[model samples]
Target: MAINFRKGIDSSLDGVTKLVFGAAWDRKAAKQSGFARKLALKSGGKINLGGGQKDIDLDLALILYRDGEPKRIVIGHNMDPVHGAAVHSGDNQTGEGDGDDETITLNLTSLPAWVTEWAVAVFAYKLGTNFDQAQNVSLNVYDASNQGSAVLLDELMPTLGAGATASIIASGKINRDATGNPIDGWTTTLVDKAGRLGSQGDDTAVLAFAKQNAGI
Candidate 1:
């Protein structure tokens, strides 16, 4: 299938049973302050202050949302599954290797009843450097059940600067019929907002952006 994404535009991925959000970045050798590290440990993640493994260069965070609010976040340090539906595949401190440096997988069919959306985002644990230090790895989504087929937006992920710390790549929502009736499946949405997106981002900022643009 052909996949496309536009900044601030809403696309549909309805009836998608399985989805994957994956990314890769060149690791920057830097460390966050002690205070910031403590805060990240205190709260699963950080807001604008930036948090996570304190040593991780970049990470893929899968956020579960209900009614536009973040209920749970899966980061480098906290890789807990959400309702047995979503799982993070360990953190890759460096984007040195090939393929996906990090990944998150979700089974839409197994999500809990209360879970409404899945927002896939990536953040540079280090705020001082942006994607320029990394490759132009466009955050991507794939059909996990279809033999890991790429959805075709490999170049859609913007190469952001050091200031743009976070990027909300895309989302998946429960499906509904034309009559506005609920269905027993889920749909996908391509949200590429790196362009025009400011440098300010964190767990809180990404959640708000996802909910507002999820088209829920």
Candidate 2:
């Protein structure tokens, strides 16, 4: 069975497991459900929340950090970072796709030595209603080898209050042994800091809070 990471919860990640972050919704739901407006949740990584934006776009972001410092970031506007360690499949405004509307791929094994923690966040752009008003909204962590199989957090994402536009639902930290020796992998958890981030345009705000809440 897929592991469920309930709201306000956290879980550890296995080093050997390669993972991907994804999210999607049914655009048609807006028309049929009588709620019409643009809404989507972006799933991306954050190396340094307090750092600066390398580039800006409506798509998801992925970042790497070392010693709590920002290292590399990749977004739709700029998909040329981390070489081949990370890849973003662009944006999905309409949620008409079969599976995930947006996605980010990460190869933990390929991460550099100085890398520390990684975080994923979501934001609502031009929202018509609160998250609760959205239809079929979900974020998930799937296996790289089996994209169809979700290992963690493959369920409905809770909606926030009206006017809230951003959220950092989850994050993972690079693990270290009890002796302070570096381990091959890290653990993940549900930071659930939603409604704190601002509109999609204010992505920088989400980045800053991600560091403290995500523990990455």
Alpha carbon lDDT of each predicted model: 0.62, 0.57
- Against the true structure, what is each candidate's TM-score? 0.66, 0.66
RMSD to native, candidate 1: 11.0
lDDT (tens digit, per residue) of candidate 1 on 95-156: 77667877777777777666767777777645464554455465656667566454533444
Clashing pairs in 1: 13-187, 13-188, 14-187, 130-162, 163-199
Q: How close is candidate 1 to the true structure, as a TM-score?
A: 0.66
lDDT of 2: 0.57
lDDT of 2 by residue, 25-85 (tens): 5542223211212111122332223222121122356656666755565555545577666
Q: Top lDDT: which candidate number? A: 1
**For model 1, where is the 10-residue window of minimal lDDT?**
47-56
Backbone clash pairs in model 2 (N, Cα, C under 3 Å; residues 3+ apart or in different chains), count:
8
